[model samples]
Target chain A: MSTLRTEEMTLNMGPQHPSTHGVLRFIVRADGEVMREAIPDVGYLHRSIEKIAEKVGYHGFMPYTDRVDYVCAMFTNQGWGMASEKLANIQVPKRGEYCRAIATEFNRLASHLLSVGTMGMDIGAMTPFTHAIREREMINDLIEELCGARLTFNYMRIGGVAWDLPPGWREKALAYLDHFEPILDEYNALISYNKIYIERLANVGIISADEAVNYNLVGPNLRGSGIKWDIRKDLPYSVYSEFDFDVPVGKGEWGKLGDAMDRYMVRIRELKESVKILRQALKQIPAGPVLAKVPRNFKPPAGECQIRVESARGDMGWYAVSDGTGYPWRVHVRTGSFAAMGIIQKLSQGLMIADLVTLIASLDVIAPEIDR
Target chain B: MEAARIYQRIKDRFGEHVLEISDHQPDPFIVIDPASIEEVGSFMRSDPELALDCLSNESGVDYKDRIEVVYHLFSYSKRHGAVLKVKLPRENPTVATLENIWKSANWMEREIFDLLGVIFEGHSDLRRILMPEDWPGFPLRKDFVEPTEYHGISTVRESPIIRLDPKKK
Candidate 1:
């Protein structure tokens, strides 16, 4: 006279599913809809970029950085370039610095756009996602026009930018900015304040300031948890400090600011700030040589130097250990998304199946950054 | 908040175990004995003045004669940072784990184990992260030799032969 009962079911999210982003698999043990344990399985997209870097010369390795964080290509470009500059002790020209700032800020906007748009799609709003990519198309066009590639724009050279700003580029960029800000307002009205979106995101994935700092979370994920830390502002590599912009933090004003909502809000706010910075950069850019005077084949003196830059996701660090050779002895990338992904296991625990998509999307965990 | 004062405090506490402290061009970094890493790391994180609560990056380097474990620690409150290095002989490069101090060290230690073949003495799950579980050698080490084939499949280094049609040829 015993009744039969079902044990907890095991579910596999993806090694190729759309919601999992790129080649990421999660094994979840759940009782009903509530997740018991979510174990992330990576390495599906491992390219051995570090090993490849050891084989190529310093300049030749720039393209590999492009493949690592495919979404935020400029950040990767800057990370690798800045690391080489630090190790080589090369000085960039003023015009080169201005262009770097403009390109990096544009990349940040594009990355944040994808994150916000994809997160919206993950949470069941398709229209906002479409609108986001429509804006991102303009960014891709600009990047392609500048670097001859859309996604992997290896436009940053060690001494400076690969090329000068094209004619009428400033006017085109300013016009895009004018058009883009209104779309952001529409995005906020459509997704950020939507009752359904807020309900799914608010207080869903909560990481306190203590835990955030302890885990070394960077970018918007760290800002979302109410910590005011941005390498661009704090370290001020390049001319980021010269320009006036805001580092938006998650105040939990809309739907527990430190949760998924805060993460979304921070990106939206940053999009506006990036626009502001781009406008300033376009207006003030001077006409001069973009490339600094360096040897045709450059080699840094034997030493190790670490360069940390704020990527769209978090603090992207490149530690270059040189041996006075064209190739680096060792180059390690401390990606922001890799650090943010650690919190996923903790955040996803005890949340429902539907909430998992929202949580992962909220963190904006890019897979190549995790696997690389 | 000068870098020297922070190095001085660490030197005062650790004594001769602090091998070398210098303010290099990029930042202030210290090299210490591999055996003393855990104790020194705990002190640096807990000290109110240093308060380097955040473990920014933890990585391993494979020099010719020895292996080095580098930890980048930062203090959010103080807006200061320091690099802690522990060098161990190549023959037996095992260092005490810092997972007790900062939880973020968990995966980073595993990665070092996978790449450089350096073992963290007390890591809960020290296994291959980037490479396959059954993969032979530590990929990042200088001594590593890439295999031409694994289980009959050609490796990435092998060039595929393109068969041209007789007419085209």
Candidate 2:
């Protein structure tokens, strides 16, 4: 049979589409099933968050950071807190640091559950998402008890957390982890190794380690590319160094290294690590006042610093500049999802239309983070 | 591979291009000439001793008189990082693009351009990434004023609590 010449087509995905994750829009130039390029047109969710930081003083800005990435708000909260603390040279009490870590790890667990559960739902597996959310709901209850808010828990303050773990909350969190760990194994058997899911994700959207580094991919995305770097383990921010937990990297067991499945597996394995860290943190949390003696009208000296937190998405960088005043001169957040979105145009070339969803889900690009 | 050593290496390699270095600050930053940014960036990334492979964070801050572009460089192999800043004229803040040296600089440069109005010369696709194409001014700039409306939609809303108060009326 003679070959047929097909015309190129331009298609728009999202700005409203569910699979685009949040308010992201992509302009895809495709020749049949293979995409020539998927140019991402972001900013639909731009709330001028960094600008808001300037308007709100250092202490008041804690709640605004929660909206930066609501899925993983703790890291944003912690990143802002750490940056301000570093700028002001304030030492968080040891007990306050442990509380921050405890609340943060639980937030990590909740964020990853939503990510993987949605990964399954985006790829046509509905049952796994419900199962994942069911587990996530328990985590929400635990976090809600700790901070009072479920989605946007503004838990961390500049020097420390808003409050200590509530009475009997430590035991409740430990019990939840004990119940949550087995569900992870059952989740793996249900969706992770399924033949169809593997075929959809394993070999698609492969990002080599060099490209991953060049693009500055952080957290699980960087580890999924087999770089073996995690800001928490390597840099030891907050109370992370005192805890005993292992960092997981993608092994490329099923397909090519740095493929979609590699990223997915990295998140799944990190969930276990979060559990391990939570177990250690709950048992070793020191007793003292969680809130430090920060003045009501706080002002740091004139200086600027960038602090990196290994958030659920990856490494979230908070670049805060203070001009020896009540208001911050400038604040910029360098987010993982922002960098991940940058590489999509290059990765989308020659990828199948359906596989585009797989690539995005695997990367776990949250829209608010990108637009912020 | 401490940050000061990394700064000293760059200072030695490009003496005239290095403008100033402040060690007193909590996080020391070396200011580089806007013209020689690409060269300094290339040297930092390729130099074996200062193998700063990743452009981890890039942001722009408007200081009213001048605009500053900050690049947070990290070395995964050497396990060290350095902060580089470029000061440009406030009127037309233009600097050489480091996108070619570091692929991650591509979107970050675009973001700086969009929010702070810094021009990255030779950037392949220098378009707004966060704001609308027709957005009036750089929202992050210190002198910027939020427009009253955009495309006929009001940007601000009256406080409902104030509106509902009978005593105020």
Candidate 3:
């Protein structure tokens, strides 16, 4: 008997596919139905914001940071603010810190909602996505109230914030939080624990805890692997230490630890944690001026420092080098998605072609964050 | 596990491979010889007491005559972190790849190579990450000139606002 000859076939996922998150292309080599390898081809959305940082002055570059991760612009805003503050040796007042924390926590929730909803959609469920967007709409309104814009919220400054909370915005945000808490359960009931959803996600794209550490996985993806490491808790910055909240790690809930389901579950758990932090920030927020009296010609000392913030995605770090001039010498945004994109190709091998979508959703590798 | 003590341990262990320590900054960094960076990196990851498991961030900065590749390492088990700097001449700044030591360094080193033109020896896939393959001069270099065109398309943005400006000289 003679065996049939077979060859590995190449497939391009997309720089335009809706499911691949943003503009990202994956050149996947497949052996029949199983993926032999998937080489990621990025740089489609490379804005070269780092180069722009050198050209633009410190204060002027805050808007550019917004585009770094539009889904979680607040985190990048905070990251840039914290980095510049450290570079300039400026301290934000307690109230200012609280305000920043409150805004950031809310942004985290908004981002996670999108991720959770979209992950549901990616795996074939659609109702949960709309449910998530409904709740997220309220959060966006509150965020827009805090910052002038909703998506690219350039709300943070070198020392503090761009604006104080609008009148009764705290009351409105608190009400939204109260209304939003039970929506999680409703959404879970709707699709999270659906048999099909579990079957689709569970035991697929399993990354060991050690592999997660090796790959420098961050955010829910790392926590889903049962690592129990969060920059907010482990390396606390801002007033994160002041507030008490649990860092939820994957405990092999539905399948093996660090499976696609575990990653999804971690995001669900984080939504509650983010709310807890927001509550503390809002209640303890003291009344004071929001923006610090930064100099017009914003020149930081000639030094470099690494500032990391627990963004919705992961440890969003900004490494800035200043040259005692208005312009930054060098700025590098170390995004969580960048590493995720690199590691995806290795993880995609030997898996079914369809599981690739599940893996991308679970990892939450948004294209702007990776490309920027 | 303070920065000073970590610096001392690495210096003692590696001897001359540990070139110098810059302790002035809040996050002190120890400069490592380019030749021994790969060895030092592997040791840093395996050493139980100093298990720098995660490569937090790897960035490159071009400083006219020299290009500095900075590696910020964080140990999850130890809960301590350290920074290592490997400086090289502006021309052909090639350092051994950390991709073997930390899987996270794969894309990061590619990024540094793309922007700053620092060649990482033994990098499994050392290619442009955020820039096109045949793109001219490294954009991050202080002396890099912006391309006039990319694939026959004008890279210049002839701004309508600038053209409409009455204050134009």
Ranked by TM-score, the better of candidates 1 and 2 is 2
Judging by lDDT against the true structure, name the best candidate. 2
Reference-based lDDT, residue A45, model 2: 89
Question: In candidate 3 chain A, where is summed lDDT lowest over 10 consecutive residues?
Answer: A1-10
Candidate 2 C-alpha error for residue A362, in Å? 0.3
lDDT of 3 by residue, B1-169 (tens): 9988998999999999988998856467899999999999999999988999999899999999899999999988989989999999998899999999999999999999999999999999998989999999899999999989999999898666644667775
Error of 2 at A203 (Å): 0.9
lDDT score, candidate 1: 0.87
Q: Which lDDT tens digits does candidate 2 get at residues A1-372?
A: 458667999999988998889999999999989999999999988888999999989988999999999998999999999999999999999999999888889889999999999999998999999999998898899889988999999999988989888889988988888888889999999999999989888889999999999999988889999999988899998889898888889888889999999999999999999999989988988878887888889999999998999999999999999999999999999999999999999999999999999999999999999997
lDDT by residue for model 3 (A218-308), tens: 8888899998889999999988889999999998889999999999999998999989988888888898887788998998888889988
Q: Model 1: what is its DockQ?
A: 0.69
Best by DockQ: 2
Number of the candidate with higher DockQ, 1 or 2: 2
Query: How does each model score on lDDT?
Result: 0.87, 0.92, 0.90
True contacts kept of each: 0.61, 0.94, 0.78
> Can you tell me which runs of candidate 2 are displaced by over 4 Å?
A1-5, B163-169
